[model samples]
Target: MVEGDTFQKFMLDALEIRGEWVRLDDSFAELCQNKNYPESLRKLLAETTAASLLLTGTLKFEGRLSIHARGSGPVSLLMAEATHERAYRSIVNHKAEPFESDDLNHLLGKAQLAITIEPDKGQRYQGIVPLEASNMGDCLVQYFDMSEQLDTFFMFDSDANGCFGLMLQKLPDYRSIQDQDAWDRVTQLANTLSFEEVSGHDNETLTHRLYHEEQVSLFAQEPVRFQCTCSPERSLASLNALGHDEVLDILEHEAKVAIDCQFCGAHYEFDRADVNALFGLGKMH
Candidate 1:
């Protein structure tokens, strides 16, 4: 088994193809332990978390990338986020009753997947794809095919302890017959991979097992951990968005204004003085 939560990149040196692998254990456990998440939700969140880390490997950015799944069923939200340095967090919002199935179609009926990227310096971007498939991996594959026009394949599996993902993409600027054939052959072999092999083994062992005949180069693994980016400063900034009059109006009744982060459950409170200081005014009457 992989030693810890990690994300890595790999290349089929001779096939003009590139791929990414991610496995999450401790980090995932920490993400789910605090909440009394049901078995089905934990499994889905695990895959989303792994998927988020895998997508971060494909982008060059200073900020963050997030996966947001929304639907009209009992479960309304499944969100996972990861930063450039691989810090990650995830959350789920659903009905009180436990879901009967873990399948995406049943849990999130008539849903859409959104991949949003917010670079620290550049313009923000988001891509959306309808959830036509029953699994997140294939939903992401659909996003790449329709929105990015990239030949990408994603596969995911999870057990009680860890979630695993493998992604293979055809490198750009390829129009040759050899490239097409190689892409087909590589993805077909990837399909043969099973949850037992993927969830229980390390990347090197998994890679050789699938592509033993081909020359594949595996890169060093980068660690991934759960880090919620919530703080008093950010919470204060949210209150700032409420504007001066609105803030005073809220203060008129309550002794303090309170905000709690849904992801980390961190709480921030602002009394009159704090609010007055925020707007650069004296004590409010």
Candidate 2:
């Protein structure tokens, strides 16, 4: 069992196809460290984390890939984002509840999952897909087919301990559209992955299971990490967006304006002095 925060890509040379796999134990642990989340919520966070990683790996984008879902169920906003630099962050909003077992549809009742790709120098693209897939993997595959018009498969698995994901996509510039036989063969192999096997095994074993029959090459792994880009400076900038009067009013009632990052639960507290300096109300000391 391979254990770490790493991503691997495998390919079948003859088929002109490639697959990406990622295991995110350490990354997910970092996300859950400061937040008090129920087991279900934690698992969802891990699932989204893995999904984001695989999606970013598949799509060659310079800036960021964001997967967000909004639902009327117990959990509301669930999102995970991964950047080209390999940074990751995940968040889930749900009220206090006991540990419970639920499928994706249950946790995300009547929801929509949106995928947004923001490139560094181009216009952003966003795709909205219904929450029809009972699992995150199926939902993402549906997204690719609808949005990109490409046949894509995504397998995402997560538990309280860790998370893992696999993605298979037909090359955009493939030669033959009638070569259903090859696509069927690869997908059939992938379909053999059981929930038990995926949830229980690690990256290496899972890859071996899916592609043992094919001549596949595994690429050098890339490290995945949980990192929050939020900072006091950035938070202060947002406070400025609230305007100077609102900042003073916030300080009037409370000792300080505390802003907590939903992704990492990192708290940024701004006191009156900090506020004054932020608004240029104090001397440059």
Best by lDDT: 1
Q: How accurate is candidate 1 locally (lDDT)?
A: 0.86
TM-score for all predictions? 0.91, 0.85
Clashing residue pairs in candidate 1 are: none
Residue-by-residue lDDT tens digits, candidate 2, 144-199? 88877778877666666677777888887555645557777898788778767866
lDDT of 1 at 48: 88
Candidate 2: stretches off by over 4 Å: 33-36, 97-101, 175-178, 194-209, 243-245, 272-285
Q: How far in Å is the alpha carbon of 281 misplaced in model 1?
A: 3.6
lDDT, candidate 1, 1-285, per-residue tens: 465799889999877788999888887877677688888888888888989998898887688999998878778898999998999999888987668887898888788889999999999999988888888888888888887688898888877778888899876654553656888889999999988777667888889998988889999989988899999888888888989899899899999999988888888899998988888889556
Q: In candidate 2, list every pair of residues with a backbone clash.
A: none
- Alpha carbon deviation, residue 186, candidate 1 (Å): 1.2
Steric overlap count per candidate? 0, 0
